[model samples]
Target: MPNHIDFVATLAPGIFSYELATGGQVILAMDVGTLVKKGSDVLVSTRNAVKAPDLGKLKQVVVQQYDVLDEREKMVRSASAKLEASLIRRFVELK
Candidate 1:
């Protein structure tokens, strides 16, 4: 599992735009720079792989990958909000 603490949650999602090899634009996540420059269809791996998946092996399109990223983003937002509220409550008690 990823250390959630490593990420800095933001008030707004970053603007993402990319085109797939199949010819369509949609976006986010993983090695974003490589994806943007190469514009290759991608494989979705819950874990890192030593070898990138073959083009024939890639199943999900760019939009589907973004959907997964979006769900995780929502979770992070909720966690950040809860953390902020708890900190505020503690600060109030301190005052």
Candidate 2:
């Protein structure tokens, strides 16, 4: 049985569009420059080797983790990190 992939929850789902693949999808996790130029896919992930099943069920658990971490990390007074996060969010929104 393939592991279900809850990309939204684990990565902190935003108001963006997504394309699911039956019960089998893969979300590649990586770090890359955000909004490098313009109109870029920042968090681009290729289908993983593992096929996801029951994305809905997995989302509940993964989203919980995302929410907890995101909430606490939201408070950052760092000028540089703040700026970077801003750009990254924008990129994610567009992508």
Candidate 3:
């Protein structure tokens, strides 16, 4: 993922803002929502919620991929530790 600074820089140079329904107070990004910059330093309101068409399916795929990667990492670490222990035991027996 690109750094936040780099990501923002790529966006069209502009200041962004979003108006909440309850009050006139300008809350930060987290409170109000994601701000998108258009052309100039102009603030454009945007929806915070993702607009994925197949969000559920995408999420399931992502979770499955993460599980596979985690299991692979655990297997590699376990094998490495076992090999290290066997090597140490052999060295001690030779002494």
Candidate 4:
């Protein structure tokens, strides 16, 4: 699939998040909960469709188009930088 190409894998103990783009046009966020690789059986929590939200699981699933997520990340990073700067200023002012 197209997503496989731009997919970035992140593995955190007890949680895993994978980012991919569908047909190189849409971004997909796949979160696998409680993954276990047995001798022969592999378990995964996945949505049924790609384009829409799948309420098949209890945990919240988010899938944003590639461009949307890029924008969000930029905004988040920008806000974070501003917050950090403010925090530092506060600390300096206290002294």
lDDT per residue for candidate 3 within 1-95, as digits (tens), equals 22233223222322233444585534222113433344434343443222222545445555665588799999999999999999999999999
For each candidate, how many residue pairs have backbone atoms clashing (under 3 Å)? 0, 2, 3, 1
Models 1 onward score TM values of: 0.41, 0.24, 0.42, 0.40
Pairs with backbone N, CA or C atoms under 3 Å apart (clashes), candidate 4:
27-66
> lDDT for each of the candidates?
0.46, 0.44, 0.49, 0.48
Better of 2 and 4 by lDDT: 4
Highest TM-score against the true fold, candidate: 3
User: Model 4: residues >4 Å from true position, as ranges?
Assistant: 1-49, 52-64
Task: Encode model 2's per-residue lDDT on 1-95: one tens digit a residue.
Answer: 13433232233222223355565344422222122122232343322221224556455645665676676666654666989999999999998
Shift of residue 82 alpha carbon in model 4, Å: 0.8
| Span of ten consecutive residues with least summed lDDT in model 4 | 49-58
Model 1 Cα displacement at 22 (Å)? 22
Per-prediction CA RMSD (Å):
14.0, 16.4, 12.6, 12.2
Pairs clashing within candidate 1? none
Give the least accurate 10-residue stretch of model 2, judged by summed lDDT: 29-38
Q: How many backbone clashes does candidate 3 have?
A: 3
Ranking by TM-score: 3, 1, 4, 2
lDDT for model 1, on a 0 to 1 scale? 0.46
